[model samples]
Target: MLLLTIDSSAGASVALTRDGAPLDAWRTEQTTSHAEVLAPAVQRMMIGAGVTGADLDGVAVGVGPGPFTGLRVGLALAHALAEAWRKPLHGICSLDSLALRATDAGVEGEFLVATDARRREVYWAQYIRDEKGSRLVRGPFGASATDLPELPAVGAGLGLYPQELRPATMDEDPSAWVPDAAELGQLAEGALVGELHGVLCQARPLYLRESDAQVPVQMRQGGS
Candidate 1:
């Protein structure tokens, strides 16, 4: 299956894959520009891979534990592309993409896939790799970086708060934190190629916390 994958949960990446292997992928190093960079990045990725919208079997996306605005950009585009191509869309947790990276890099024992959720907290998921694939042993939890139990940590959360925990080997690789669209594609290629209905039927954004734009109850109650 030819799959196009997108993820903006951290930096933002677009990829093309066949079966479960990546053909080519693109990512922005500047983390804050998802809205500005995502649409064009997707276009470039497909073009570079020598594919067209019609060439895609389906779409896969990172369903985030990320900020409201950034997370939605990728999800909206995935939905639009899937609808445009008339193909199934699959959503995978963005942290799963991070965990896959760790497993691929040979991180042994269980560890945390952490990403900066801002507000001094992180979006964390725990995983252990077995022969099948990585398993989520704990969280898709959102909490203060300090609150998470100590494990070798991987992801952007460590970059943001160096004081929080012992860094995993991946912490040295800057790209480690950014969700890889290629990895997202690998995770969802099975659904795209086979029974799309049985797995993720839609590409949905996973915002684990409320939007920053939402007023706190105390602040709202005092407002005229």
Candidate 2:
């Protein structure tokens, strides 16, 4: 199956996958540039892979437990493409993608998977790695880094909260933190084949906290 996968919650990433394996991918490290980086990355991958939006069999997106802006941009684009192409779409948790990548990177023992949530907080989940795959142990919740359990840690949140959450060990530099598109596509494929259970959801941003954007005073007061 030809699939296009995208995750912009942490470090914006896009990829084209075939039958669950990645055919082409690109990721940008700038966390705030999702709107800027997303379109070109998607366009480049599809053009390089010699496919167009119409050629996609499905769209797989990382529905995020992330910051409001970056997460929304990715979901909107994925939904728009799906609607334009009249194709099926699946929404995978951004944390699941991080967990899958961490396991593949050889992180053992119980650890927390996290992403920078700004405002000195993180979106995190506890996981135990086994031969089959990662099992989500604790959360896809938002918490201050100081409140998280001290365990081995991975993802951008580690760097963001270094003074609070220490690592069990570091397999790679902290700069490598971000969701992986290949894993998201594998998850989407598993969802189709029934190898994985139902964790994916509709395209919605997991902004666990209130967005910084508040209703205008006039709107809130019903002034128009």
- In the range 150-211, model 2's lDDT, one tens digit per residue, is 78887878777778776546566643477877889988887777787765788778889899
Candidate models: Cα lDDT each = 0.80, 0.83
Q: Clashes per prediction?
A: 0, 0
Q: Find the candidate with the highest lDDT and give its number.
A: 2
* Candidate 1 residue lDDT tens string, 1-224: 88889988877899898988989888886667888888888888777777898888888888887889988988999899999989878788888787777888888778888888888888998887677555778668899988988888888888787887667765357324767888888878865566322334346777887787877788889955
Task: State model 1's lDDT.
Answer: 0.80
| For model 2, the run of ten residues with the poorest summed lDDT | 167-176
Error of 1 at 139 (Å): 2.2
TM for candidate 1 is 0.85
